[model samples]
Target: MSEILSAPAPQVGNAESWTRREILQQPETLRATQALLRARQAAIEAFLSPLLARNDLRIVLTGAGSSAFIGDSLAPWLSMVMGRSIEAIATTDIVSAPALHLRAGAPTLLVSFGRSGNSPESAAAVDLTEALVDSPHHLIITCNAEGDLARRAGANTHVVVLPDATHDRAFAMTSSFTAMMFAALSIFSGIATMEARAEVIAKALADTLMDADQRMAALVEHGFERVVYLGSGALKGLAREASLKLLELTAGALVTAFDTPLGFRHGPKSIVTDRTLIVVFVSNDPLTRRYDCDMIEELRAEARCGAVLAVSAQPMEGDALHIPHLEDAADADLLIPFILPAQLFGLHASLKLGLMPDTPSPSGTVNRVVQGVRIHAIGA
Candidate 1:
């Protein structure tokens, strides 16, 4: 862990950019995040123990943009572990139509993820849940201690404010996203349970960061006009976040698409062209891996795309970036390491386009905390 902590930042674009620092500081941030969770284990359990006892408790994970994708990535895995159907609904969706997504009869737990925790929809969604649900508990996981979500702590709410460093200064999320996702996963899965696994996960992420920058930089040289990210199950959510990272960092300079490996064959495969770069996030599950590998082979066999790259924990045959020490890890653990290549590629691509990775959007159309969202009253 010291090696990762002391490793020099990758020389991508302006070395002093917050984007690069946030992206590179993940190894340290992850360790710090878990350590905080471990220290707060008693209080966390105190808050959650009684909630877990309810047979009819409805658990909903919500957020916006990159934050929303955190729930997308973890909902399925958490559902399996908790033995209940957990819902991953975006704050935007709930704020828009609370009736469709929330139930007033059921006792509910709303798990919200936010980096800045100031997004209009974030607080609005929580307000709507409190107004509509019969019995609602709030678990606000955010990087910002000063953000609105953290201030919502009360009798019915518990807030987990992450380390200040995770409150990303860059326009796009890198470490903030991973840290909040890890926090929610740790809280739900048991902090102590993750203690044994955290070191390997951090080490694997460090290895990927150390090894991926040059490769990602070279990949950016290809200048593919479009990119597609594919995965299965939990990895499918990761593919979505990966796609968003590229789109946001590149500022829409490169068209990007994301879908499950099997779903891509249905219609999305048509997006692949001679100038398209297709990257697959291969699953570690033996059954799911075969399907993911099949897609990789099929795309390669067709030879229509610019290139096909696989990011996998398992050893791959060709054209893949293999993450070390996670070959047998659960797909949930693979999420953080698996995202390194995409993050690096996004950073390098921004640098390649002469755009500041810290603020890729030149116009005021996009913002770090997001803008132009007006949270209307429920009946408005």
Candidate 2:
């Protein structure tokens, strides 16, 4: 841990790319996010207390693209902690089939995550939930203070606008994803509980950022054509986000996949090739860590893929990225630090491909704020 703390500062990269800056700014942004949340805890709890008291309230986490993955990563852990089933429904799915997803009779609390808060599906999902649920409450978490979602504060709604730095300028989300994710995790799990853990998490993130660039850059030099991200429990959702980061930053030049380490054996394991790179997010839970280790060892022994890397808080035998001072931390706390290497890898991969990391797609098919989305009326 002392070695990690004393590590030299990150090597500077292309000055023009906001992607690298946003990726590297996570430690600071996350601390800022937690500080803001701490200051607002009284009011936030006042707003959420009544709704949480009700036994029938249904909590739904919704977002689109990377924002959506935040819910995917958090839902399971939060559900267990809160002692209730929490739904992680993507805004894309909610907008398309409101009737199918929304329960008219259930009291609902929609926790919406948006970096820009302007995604058509994000607004549409909130609208659909409001219209479809007889009793609906909204907790809008957004990085954009001026976004449509942030302006949604009302008697039944509360909006948390994160620090401006988290409103990432890059096409793909880096800081925004982790910041928003930390906010949601802190909110649902209790801000004070996370207050104790936040600095440790941030330090681990700083350490990971310090060591990640060169390691990920070296991996990019291998020119692996495919990448797979695997994890379990809360980490499974993280695996999905990691896969998306590589895919988006590389502009889909590299084929990517994500699944639980155990689930990968069922069928997804077939995607591996000698040109493939597989990364496993090793869990901190004793039982889950065993399974994660088993998969990591299995993949390495198979020798089918070009490389297998384990990202772990605890030491492992083979190729691994070790995160410091979080060996006893909850798996949820691991999410932010665990994602650093993947985000760095994506940036390095984009540069290696001769593409701009800030805006990977040359064609206007994808935008910083998504385009070509037409929100339609429910019945029309």
Candidate 3:
């Protein structure tokens, strides 16, 4: 087992910025999220009980950017456990074609994920759902209590506001992203209630953090022009989020891409270069692990990419970053902890590039929360 010890807070250095701080503080926020779920369990159950029992319920998980990726990460696992269909749609897509997404008069529940909860698309998606569908219920999971999505709470809408500290003062989301993902996992996955499985997630993160941090620092120091994150199933969603973190932090200085292990071999492999670092989030399931391992070996043999790494709980034949004590963890449970290293790499890479992790974008073109997004009126 490895130790992810909390060092004394520094006024300067890599941990100086709020983004890095948020990235480092994720384990604590996850623990806090556990407590938040325990506290709100009954009310959440009460609200969801009837909805879960419905034969005609339509649950759509929606958001934008990293927020949208949450639905991608959660939908597959949530759908299987509950034995129902769950759709992950980005708010950007919904706003563009509400008619395609929102079915009229369907018993719908819109789970909208946001860090600040103020993105124009967040509000527009909820409104579009109302305009085109029946009286739809809303589950707003966010860190900001005063943001538009949270304020939209009413008789038919329920909002779960996470810790304020997790709101992330940084321009790029770190803590908020994971915390909200934890919240959703806790709410939607029946397995989250099983103490043993929950322990797998918490303990794996505790042990892996420091080990991953040290390794990631070296990767950033070595430097790379492009990085690729790969995974399958629930982890594919994680890969997308991880890729976004790198792209956003470097302010386009470092190009990043993501795809499933099998999907990567199909043409997308062209993106790989001598300057590329390929990261695969290896699956725990034995069958899926075969494909993941095959990709790792194939990439290593090609010697085209600068480096190849795998994050896995399962024992591997080659050198890899192992998240200890989760050898038997289900793939869904692996999603949360699997992302920490990717997020840390983004932070370290951003800092190494001599950019502020808190404000990666020095110019005003991009923002902490998007600006100048025009939400249009929907009508006949």
- Models 1 onward score TM values of 0.96, 0.96, 0.94
Ranking by lDDT: 2, 1, 3
Candidate 3 or 1, higher lDDT: 1
Local distance difference test, per candidate?
0.90, 0.91, 0.85
lDDT of 1 by residue, 176-248 (tens): 9999989988888889999978889989988888678888989899989999999899988899999999999
lDDT (10s digit) by residue, model 3, range 308-361: 999998766666899888888788788878988998898889888888877788
Q: Which ten residues in a row have the lowest lDDT in candidate 2?
A: 1-10
In model 2, where do residues sit more than 4 Å from their true spots?
1-16
Which 10-residue span in candidate 1 carries the lowest summed lDDT? 1-10
Q: Report the C-alpha lDDT of model 2 over 22-114, residue by residue, as the tens digit.
A: 887788898899999999999999999999999999999999989999999999999999999999999999999888899999999999999
Clashing pairs in 2: none
RMSD score of candidate 1 (Å):
2.1
Residue pairs in candidate 3 whose N, alpha carbon or C atoms collide under 3 angstroms: none
Query: Sorted on TM-score, highest at the top, how do the candidates line up?
Result: 1, 2, 3
lDDT of 2 at 28: 85
